[model samples]
Target: MAEAAPERVYTEQEVEAYLGENLPHWKLERGWIRRTYRTHSWKSTLMVVNTVGHLAEAAWHHPDITASYAWVEVRLATHSAKGITDKDFALARKIEDVVCWQPGREGGPLEGTPAGDPRFAYIKYDKT
Candidate 1:
């Protein structure tokens, strides 16, 4: 079997450019790309953590996560490559897509959590 090639490590400038164009909510800090998701409560925070954990496990690229009663922060870096890489960006994109999805806005069957009802509220979706 052939070994895979080394992943390319992105420079600070490159990371910044990608974040600006594709991931406006994510930022570069201390060689890691980070994003903080605000949730409605502790239950929502755990949901976010578990969602991210599943995604990271499936992708085989993990991130450092911090969670409080109302927020979850995810930080990604390529530890093996010693810097940010494509994997970090890819995982970040997937996380953002799943976490920020609002089915109600798409006119789909899933009405999404009722924003007005605190009982069903989960993530605090950012207004466009």
Candidate 2:
């Protein structure tokens, strides 16, 4: 029997739908699924850093990470391809599952907030 190929590349619209239905922790932003984690302190932050590093290594898909005393921001983007891919979303979902969130999860200072960026909106698609 022939092996089935993995669906790796997806249009931005498709990715938006996928993220909306399957991954609530992810948000479509700047062509990437952005998620942030808050830690108790610097030590906890380091722990998450190492854990994230290992996860990224295992997936063989790296993410842009910003860490500080109380938080770590994880951004997924396929820069080389200039858009999001299955690898990026897969890794984002995995990271979300691993990280524990509190009541106010998104309050932590975002490292690089893209203010008023138009690229994050759902891209128009042609169904016909």
Candidate 3:
């Protein structure tokens, strides 16, 4: 069996540029790419954590996650590579897409959770 090639680690400048152009909400800090998601309640926070867990497991790339009563913070880096790499960015993009999805704005049949309603509120999506 052939071994996988080494992943290319991204420099800080490259990470910054990618974050600016592709993921405006994410930032590079302490040698890792990180993003924090705000939620309406603890339930929502757990949902975010579980969602991220599922995505990470499916992608076969994991991220360090921290959660509290109303927020979740995700930090991504390539542990084996000892730096941020393409895998981190790819997983981050997937996490952002799924975590921040709002079906109501997509003109699709699925109307998302009711806006301005605490009972149905989940993620506190960043305004674009």
Local distance difference test, each candidate: 0.96, 0.70, 0.96
Candidate 2 residue spans exceeding 4 A from truth? 1-8, 101-128
Backbone clash count, each prediction separately: 0, 0, 0
Model 2 per-residue lDDT tens digits across residues 1-128: 99666446678788889888877656778767776676557776787888889999999889989988877878888776677887887788777656543323466664332335643211111121
Off by over 4 Å in 3: none
Show where candidate 1 strays beyond 4 Å: none
In model 1, the worst 10-residue window by lDDT is: 108-117
Candidate 3 per-residue lDDT over residues 5-56, each given as its tens digit = 9999999999999999999999999999999999999999999999999999
Instruction: List pairs with backbone clashes in candidate 2.
Output: none
Order candidates by lDDT, high to low.
Answer: 3, 1, 2
Model 3 lowest lDDT segment of ten: 115-124
Model 3 clash pairs?
none
Clashing pairs in 1: none
The TM-score, computed over Cα atoms with residue i paired to residue i, of candidate 2 is: 0.65
C-alpha lDDT of candidate 1 relative to the true structure: 0.96
Alpha-carbon deviation at 126 in model 3, angstroms: 0.5
